[model samples]
Target: MKMEDYTVEFCPWCCEEVVIHAVGITACPSCGKPLAPCSVCWDAHGGCREPCPYGCAGAEADEQKPVTTPPITQEEIDFVMANY
Candidate 1:
């Protein structure tokens, strides 16, 4: 799906509102935090859960990965500077 098809979700790390695609990882526009949709699970109680019960793809692998911010490229810096 295209970027526009994804819902705007909050960054679990920074609590900033941002748009991240349902598949793959994307950086938060506000805090530059990277996340994949499967990184956190939304429970029926409307609370976040780690390791989704529904077995979302990459959920187990994501749990094994360390939380680290990817290096920002010049293009990203320029885009942010130009826009904000």
Candidate 2:
């Protein structure tokens, strides 16, 4: 089997995997992260062609997510105890 046939691309910024099958990509389709030109190789993932170690799962989920509630801080707890 050819290695080129099973090559995968990963986002350099978010470390998300790209699902599409293509080469010479300028940006990651998953996270829209700008891809850097590999200095040593011309393939989609340079010579390694391995999945990102960071393992983002899916960057698109992060991009489309909305802001959630903030966590309580120590200051808030201290203030409540002091006031009470």
- Cα lDDT listed for each candidate: 0.50, 0.38
* Best by the TM-score measure: 1
Alpha carbon deviation, residue 80, candidate 1 (Å): 18
Itemize residue pairs with steric clashes in candidate 1. Answer: none
- Model 2 lDDT on a 0 to 1 scale: 0.38
Query: What is the lDDT for 79 in model 2?
Result: 46
C-alpha RMSD of candidate 2: 18.1
**Model 1 misplaced stretches (Cα beyond 4 Å):** 1-4, 38-84
RMSD values for the candidates in order, in angstroms, are: 7.4, 18.1
Candidate 1 residue lDDT tens string, 1-84? 233334356565687655544445556656665565543346677765655543434344443343344443445445444453
| Candidate 2 Cα misplacement greater than 4 A, ranges | 1-6, 36-84
Q: Which ten residues in a row are the worst by lDDT in model 2?
A: 63-72
Cα TM-score per model: 0.40, 0.29
Candidate 2 per-residue C-alpha lDDT over 1-84 given as tens digits, one digit per residue, 9 for 90 to 100: 222322244555567643322223244444554443233234474453345322223455433333222322345434433443
